[model samples]
Target: MSKTVVAVFSSRGRAEQAVSSLREAGFNKEISIAAKGEDHKGGRGNTDYFGATMAADAGDGLSDGVAAGGLLGGLAGLAVGAGALVVPGIGPLIAAGPIAGMLSGAATGGIAGGLVDWGIPEAEGRQYEEDVKQGRILVSVQASDNKADEAASILKSQGADRVKTH
Candidate 1:
């Protein structure tokens, strides 16, 4: 699988610094930086909001699964899996019942779908989003497992105080 590893920095400049270091470390062509406000819509469309909302819904769905294990679980599951709710040829199946099924199915499908959407594995994407919400910057790289350590090493060398690999 093509994997993306992200290194979180404290500031946009620090992220840039890490990018520069990554370039020097031989990942120049593959590295990219997501600077704040660089791709903003002046408060209209917010990627962060979307990402965070998705994470929250997923979390809620998981919590519901642990709580009720039936109807609520299905509802929570749907909310969590809302990001992957797509209809091919037909329109969206917006009914609560089916939506709940989609959410319930998320326990399995959401993982792969989320990974595909975030460009990282499902577990990694959740963790990354959590870290970002806590005010940390994320640096992601896509490569083989062997290269993950080296990429992490470079980020840490450039002042990434805390690093998590998934």
Candidate 2:
């Protein structure tokens, strides 16, 4: 199965730089960057924005979709919760097959319809909301399991401060 990985950088410039390095490292098509931070007044603005953005982006891994079932989910949840107090939201729920199936059923009704209409569960939805509230940026990548490790390694080599693999 294909998995997603996220790399968090300290600044937009660093993030962009990492992207460039990642590309050179052979992960050109698999990397992305998001600038996170709060808008504020004067010099405080820059600091607040960078801090908020980092928290938000870093906290994203614990949300529902990113962390569903298995070890990855648990680790993501713990990491997010501990790092930023963000809860796992729809991301995790949708990733969890049972919850996703239930949400699909609630949305459409029939098993076939439910199967076709994928959705995350309520609990997970709530978790996503919490993650956002914490003010974090999110970077997502979809790649095969084997590629995930390499992608993460490339991001790290390129100076990604925090890299999460799922």
Candidate 3:
């Protein structure tokens, strides 16, 4: 059996460490990380919101054209798995990791819906969405049942808030 683990962090720095820790623990294949703005209309997050920059060898950040409106400058010269995106109702978002695909997959549903689809309870999904909107970072990993405890421990050690299994 496998377990989907989710945790919320207060900042990008901690979020990044949790991701790296999970990877080092051998849960690298299906990790997901995401963040939302905390101040003003849109949160002002720098590129390293996830703690570490993507290695150049990881590929490249995705892009197309720029959108007008929020804090996101646009997806230009970004590291792999990171991009500037706009989430409906949340405005401009700078995200990395697997969340880049979740946000970019559709225009309307975006992260909150994706969170629900990922097996997070609807209420908790909305709470996570709101936390991100308020400048929080979230990391999730799919781990086998045997590794679930270890994964959650890694996240907790890195100051992950509300760490839970789905």
Candidate 4:
């Protein structure tokens, strides 16, 4: 697996820029973006999220043809496969790309849960979720350890907050 780098931004615009910069910097791996449930332009009740009801499951692989919500509509250009979703800890959220695709199989938890699965601390994952709840946009990418440092630097220069690596 590749080293992972996460960058949080106060706005979707900045997050998008970071994605672009990371892409430009040759960190062309899977990039995932997530935003608050309220930041999107539509309702959570809509049939746009990847819907799979589960009483409990750690995480499953994604199945295709799931409903992607309005939260992902605007992020389509930036995040590879943007979609709106609801995980356990995180209420309603917008997500994009392979990370979200992997989450397409998740049922028991939210973004925080996914972060935990990826080795991020539980407390830090929760904090990341809270940041999203506050209208921050999150961008995550997997690269070589050295490249992750470069990605973090790129995000910092682009005004990314909460730059983290794992």
Candidate 5:
């Protein structure tokens, strides 16, 4: 069986490092990240927010264009499908990998509701949502039961707070 491991980071830098370590440890595909987006409006009407924010391999930081909106550093490139979107009560959010899809469809539900689909308890999901709103970062890994511990360890080592598995 698979389990979802979630961790919260105080800063995006730490979150990026955690994700890089996870990728290096071979958790590439199942990892996802969600962070409070820049305090600006998302894509205009009909604009492709998801496609337009593809993270590029721009050395240490995001490429000029992607940085203006999406993730920072190579972390952007590390994510499979990065994008920006607006959730009803959560404002704009920058998300990548599997979570982006969930947020895209969570317009009415917000990040907490989207997390429930990942098997996180609703109360915990709400707490995570509040964390992001307060400028923290959320990193999650969907791994086999046997690998969940390792993933959690990686996250904890990279300075994650409130690391938990569900």
Candidate 6:
């Protein structure tokens, strides 16, 4: 069986560090990240995290495509499908990996709804959503039962808050 481990970070740097650590730990896939877009400041801008224009439709939102070469810091050059999504009530957000697609399709339901689909309890999902709205970053890793604890540990060692595996 496989399990999903999720955590929230108070800073983008910490989230990126967790991601890097996960990658170093042999987790090259099934990693997801979501953060309040750099342009999410009072919903006042058109640019995304990498300065890509936000699209009206979810299908086109990922127009930026592969983000391995665009992101900076610890997340730089990490091969993953990424883009900007305009979420209802949450404004614009920069999302990458599997959760990015979920957030795109979620629309009115937002992040919490997507997390529920990932097996996260509704109330916990809502709390995570609230944390993101408060400007934290969310990171999740889907791993086999044998590796679930390791994934969670990597995230926790990187300073992840509320690290939970479900």
How well does candidate 5 score on lDDT at residue 67?
40
lDDT against the true structure, per candidate, is 0.41, 0.37, 0.62, 0.64, 0.74, 0.74
TM per candidate comes to 0.44, 0.39, 0.71, 0.74, 0.80, 0.82
lDDT of 6 by residue, 97-155 (tens): 88888887775798899999889999998998898788888888989999999999999
Off by over 4 Å in 1: 1-3, 35-124
For all predictions, the C-alpha RMSD in Å is: 14.1, 13.8, 7.4, 5.7, 7.1, 4.0
Better of 4 and 6 by TM-score: 6
lDDT of 4 by residue, 9-89 (tens): 886667777888877877554688876544222333333222322112212333222233222344445757765555665
1-166 per-residue lDDT for model 2 (tens digits): 7665755554445554555555565653343322222333332111233232122122333232221221322212211121111222222111122322233334333222322222324454333334433443333344688788877776677665567665
**TM-score attained by model 2:** 0.39
Runs in model 4 with CA error above 4 Å?
39-73
State which candidate, 3 or 5, has the greater lDDT: 5
Evaluate model 2: give its lDDT: 0.37
What C-alpha root-mean-square deviation, in Å, does candidate 3 show against the real structure?
7.4
Model 3 lDDT, full chain set: 0.62
Q: What lDDT score goes with residue 7 in model 6?
A: 92
The positional error of residue 76 in candidate 2, measured at the CA in angstroms, is 25
Question: Which sections of candidate 2 miss by over 4 Å?
Answer: 37-138
Clashing pairs in 4: 48-67, 48-68, 48-69, 88-109, 88-110
